[model samples]
Target: MASGNVSSVTEFILLGLTEQPELQLPLFFIFLGVYVITMLGNLGLLILIGLNPHLHTPMYFFLFNLSFVDLCYSSAITPRMLISFVKENVISYGECMTQLYFFCFFVIDECYLLTAMAIDRYVAICKPLLYRVTMSNQMCFMLIMGTYMMGSSGAIAHTVCMLRLTFCDGNIIDHFMCDGPPLFQLSCTSTNVNKVVVFTIVGINVLVSSVTIFISYTSIISTILQISSTKGRSKAFSTCSFHIIAVSLFFGSAAFMYLKPSSTGSVNQDKVSTVFYTIMGPMMNPFIYSLRNKDVHVALHKALKKRMFF
Candidate 1:
């Protein structure tokens, strides 16, 4: 591939999740349902938290932002993904970059936001006396803002680096979405800088967030164990249980997808891993939080009953 050819390339074909004709329609329907659930569940949770005065606490405030991030995260990839299943999956270079940018933004935002939520839980459980003072409204707002800023900065770094690489090779992207690893594989120019930048930024982001969550939960669990009553321990564990489940799913899938050596992993494997976080994670988060959470269940029931009475 010549430099001129690379410079002239304006679009790329997405190979999508699979090449089998028989699987496309089935996968399409499956992801379509996932997208719909993700949207409705996250949006409903957002509205519920906003309208219910009882939920106006630091915990629910973090949850509200989580719902918002899930909504955007799923939207960024799923809609384009659905189109690929039914039609041609050609994406212009610019559109692909845009998709990658937003995808990175929301995914990173969710990472740090989950960390912040864990810290909130830590304060609530481990330092109950200081919870209110530590996680004040202004403080919560700053935490949320910081997560978004971190996400944006990482996204910009990745996109800007990607824009520098030339793509003269075959324009076929092996995966469904414009992901960094797959995109790097297609670059005609040296992707050493892009790879290093991605690894560094992602490493710092995931490491900081994961370590924070781990430390926070360690303190939280220790504090829970100190509670004398079985009921007290169960209640405290229950509060963080849903968060633990969500964080595991989000971070576990993400780490497997991004942190692994790209050469050692097959594209098919990558697709499956990506599906877990990108499609399934968002779809399941609202249910994970709501079904396991007694307060959310109570608030939902109350809201429904109020609506029925009206």
Candidate 2:
């Protein structure tokens, strides 16, 4: 046991989604396309929000932050995964840890941010009279700050705990990225404490965010139902529909990936689930918000027309 605890591996080889040689190039092109779309879509949205004075509101403010987070989040994992497709998929121990930390940070940030967005929607829809006062500029800034702080604290906690564990097991990481569960499997030291910390932090983040969203939407739905006109109700629902879809896709895929018991046979399934949230989610968010949003479409058209005219 002591021998096993002695450090021998300095780097780990990532198996990267599949061991099939034939599939590697195809998956590479697929994810490269996804990454390209993720960058363009999110960046375009950010630029649109920044330039359009009409979009300078509390909702787009939160969206600006969301797009930034999604950009950073996807960059943290996707670039490295892309590299794995073409090169020898080896990552240094320190590099892997850094990747894990940022991945956790952005993911947790997103969870809380989505909750904040839900709260924003609730205040706007359910308490329109108080929306201006309740979601003032200072208040929105503080909420965004708090989300980052919570995410940083959680990431720090997980990374610090993981650092204490010694990894002397074989140097192959089964998944494409250096995630908690797969990394834990490589640790030769007792991982009970690490597991406990992970479960506690993740459970709290997911639970609190999920509950907040649930309560906010409950109020939002009730308020919408009270509207006397069908058109009014539809209008109200449309306002939150994009957010609802984004939240459902993010949480559903994440819950499927992290909440399940770790099993050796499920690595491929885990990879697929991870791709949904980390890769596909970011790619889809800008489309989800912009395609359904009239304001975004209007702003985009005005911007394009201005560019063409200039």
Candidate No. with top lDDT? 2
> Per-residue lDDT of 1-310 in model 1, one digit per residue for the tens?
2355235468988989898999999999998998999999999999999998999999999899999999999998998888888988999988999999999999999999999999999999988899889999999999999999999999999999999988876788988999999888778789999989988988898899999999999999888988999999998988889889989988888888878886787889999999999989999999988897777888899989999999
**Residue 292 deviation, candidate 2, in Å?**
1.5
Residue 208, candidate 1: C-alpha displacement in angstroms: 0.5
Residue pairs with colliding backbones in model 1 are none
Worst 10 residues of 1 by lDDT: 1-10
Error of 2 at 195 (Å): 0.9
Displacement of residue 204 (Cα, Å) in model 1 is 0.5
TM-score of each: 0.97, 0.96
Q: How many backbone clashes does candidate 1 have?
A: 0
Model 1, which residues run further than 4 Å from truth?
1-7
Error of 2 at 8 (Å): 3.1
lDDT of 2 by residue, 96-194 (tens): 999999999999999999999999999999999999899999999999999999999999999999899888878899988989888898988898898
Evaluate model 2: give its lDDT: 0.91
Q: How far is candidate 1 from the true structure (C-alpha RMSD, Å)?
A: 1.6
